[model samples]
Target: MKRTLSLILLTIALGACSTQKPANDPALVGTWKGLRTQTDKCQFLSWTTHLKPDGRFTITFFRDVQQTQAIQTEQGTWSAVNGKNELRTDGVRMPDVYTYQLVDADTVRYVSVAAGPSGDCQEDYAFTERRLR
Candidate 1:
């Protein structure tokens, strides 16, 4: 009886260690599009972001709200940290943190907390993005 109990405990411990943790913010693992207006100028910037389940992301930026002209594209990785989202792009030194919340079933809001190397126009910026269906 003593040997059987020890074996059972060991098996249970090993099984627990082998279990995988859930992915970070699984609901944000899709394509999202939004338009952010510049605070100091009459500029409307349109962006489309694709967040993968593998913690990778790609964002394409356009100058107009209609997204007819492509400006640039950036690749990065993102993760959820302390109820906020942290995005780290390639060639950037620091990560950009944002407060993310769900606006509706298909829409989400992201407010910038800290600016990074992504060429943000100003501070105190917020944008609403809809998940591409």
Candidate 2:
């Protein structure tokens, strides 16, 4: 009887040590810098966005070589849907639903998946973002 109890205790300890908490989407309440590496003219475009917990975000696209000038700025509300696998932005021109993939707590990739007319084409805008802090 003692040997059986010891075996059960050992099994329980081993199981506890082998398990880990599952990873989930990180909080979006921070600053993120993103860049698009591919464009039609092969020019690089970068943007910095600040997201607040109140569901508001402000994104400014860089337009200068020094990254000091902004060509445009977008302010809107953003939310994650489909169990945080997708991001929906409202109040932005050309609002798109993107494939939101979080690699870790500090990294994410956004891919535009909206199809064009007839569903034969889709915008290939893809960008990866890193947390500022």
Candidate 3:
């Protein structure tokens, strides 16, 4: 009876481990673009991001003026953390971490929280439209 109880307990433990969430696929390996929306001002911002296979990424922010002119652009690199669910950008003026969720094979959504010059700023969660080569 003792041996049987031990076997059942071990089996249950192993089963629980097997039910763990699978690791995210490394298919997040390309460039993506999206319309950035500012939560505070309710304005639309343009942005682009490139995810490399070497666990590195680059992002660019653009501003559209009068629906025709490109007014500004900011570029930076990204490093992945927390099993690729979080990323930190290099040289970003804001001190915050961006959390990501894979939407599909080619798309992802990222949310960023930071302290703006005036107060706390949180970006509306935005979907990244994947760019396929």
Best by TM-score: 1
Q: Clashing residue pairs, candidate 3?
A: none
The number of the candidate with the highest lDDT is 1
Cα deviation of 96 in candidate 3 (Å)?
3.8
Which digits, one per residue and each the tens of the lDDT, describe model 3 over residues 61-120? 566522344544434444554424434445555544556667777776666644333223
Q: Which lDDT tens digits does candidate 2 get at residues 39-128?
A: 556566678888776666787888654569787776766665443432334543444456777778898777777622321124676667
What TM-score, over all chains together, does every model reach?
Answer: 0.78, 0.62, 0.52
Tens-digit lDDT track of model 1 for 1-133: 9999999999999999888544678778899999987665547789999989899999999998888899999998898744589889988998888899987768988888888865666477778899998
Judging by TM-score, tell me the better candidate of 1 and 2: 1
Clashing residue pairs in candidate 1 (N, C-alpha, C atoms within 3 angstroms): none
lDDT of each: 0.85, 0.65, 0.57
CA error at residue 123 for candidate 3, angstroms: 5.1
What lDDT score goes with residue 61 in model 2? Answer: 81
RMSD list, candidates in order:
4.7, 10.8, 8.5
